[model samples]
Target: MIRNTILLAAGAAALFLSGCGEPRAYGKVDKTPYEIRECNKELYRGIDTDPEKHIDKIVVHKKKRELAMYKKGKLIYACKVSLGKNGDKGDKVQAGDYRTPEGSYRIVRKKCDPRLYKSLMISYPNAEDKARARANGVKPGGYITIHGQPKWNADGHADRFTLAHDWTEGCMAVSNKAIDALWIAVKNGVKIDIYP
Candidate 1:
């Protein structure tokens, strides 16, 4: 009888404690949020005052930690890029912990979670990378791609000023909105040179 009473008291205590826990906040997202895809299409269709300029390719320099977009061999856009969390100058990332690779590559494919507003797949670990990694006995890092905020922020809205700095593991990253524009402009097999 005593044991039964003790068990009942513990259960009641647990229930009471659970009810006293803090309540989580739940509310609708602000309607002011920006949409990347819509913005990208608008930019592409807009009249260009400078018809002579055209973006041709992209170059990622690890030493300079920068991302430069080019057109007809002239730089059209340039921005800073954050490399692997471990910092620049290292072998390919064997695991996924947000580390950017260091080398020249090309944009081979572009894919997204669809659920995710934007993402671009870059072809990393070329023959040179594979040979280098094999020489060192470490696997070349793989799955390098440009992407936007994860599903948690799938609305494709993120503060640009804050995200402008380097922040990708091995892949290049721009604002979810900016990335959307690049996705349309850059095609598959477009050369992307990453320097160390």
Candidate 2:
């Protein structure tokens, strides 16, 4: 009887360890068909809309859901933002962990997508992120970005309901209209600071 009890305990321990071994994957990329629309120039009439306005910094307050733009140490614009679904807990630590990273990063790349609206690549899993993941014996995921909503259907319509929620895997999300402005306002190599 003692031998059987020991075997059962060993099996339970193995199950528990396996459960704790890896992070679960979250979020899905939408691939529905979409088309770009010509934005109304009048939509961005007020304030300084010039790319030369010298806006060079982005600060994201994850808990507060705020994204503020700065130019030469002055506030240029501010808007609401949505972070990863699991972002409230802490900075992302491994692949498949649905938490946005917190730290200083740069806009490494930019790509225009009809389905996803627009995307600004963030340099996640930097040296420090990699180090943390290495220490934990896990892979640090990549492909993090600041992007707009996806086209949900063939009509090129965006799901406004989804846009109003925090649902990304590990990226910053903004409205398509807001991304339009950001696309022109933000330049590559601009510094982005994400705070918890």
Go through the candidates in order and give each one's C-alpha lDDT.
0.55, 0.69
* TM-scores of all candidate predictions against the true structure: 0.61, 0.71
Per residue, candidate 1 scores C-alpha lDDT tens digits across 23-91 of: 224354332233545534544666312334435688877667677878878877776554554445454
Instruction: Point out where model 1 deviates above 4 Å.
Output: 1-54, 89-93, 96-98, 114-116, 154-168
| Displacement of the residue 184 alpha carbon in candidate 1, Å | 1.5
Candidate 2 Cα lDDT to native: 0.69
Q: Supply the TM-score for candidate 1.
A: 0.61
With candidate 1 superimposed using the best TM-score fit, by how many Å does residue 102's alpha carbon deviate from the native?
A: 2.2
How many clashing residue pairs are found in candidate 2? Answer: 0
Q: lDDT by residue for model 2 over 1-196, one digit each (tens)?
A: 9997875466444322221111234346233243332322222343323558557899999989888889889998887777777778799998778788999999887664544556788888799999999999999988788877654422323334444556677788777767767877876788999999
Candidate 2 wrongly placed segments (more than 4 Å): 1-50, 153-160
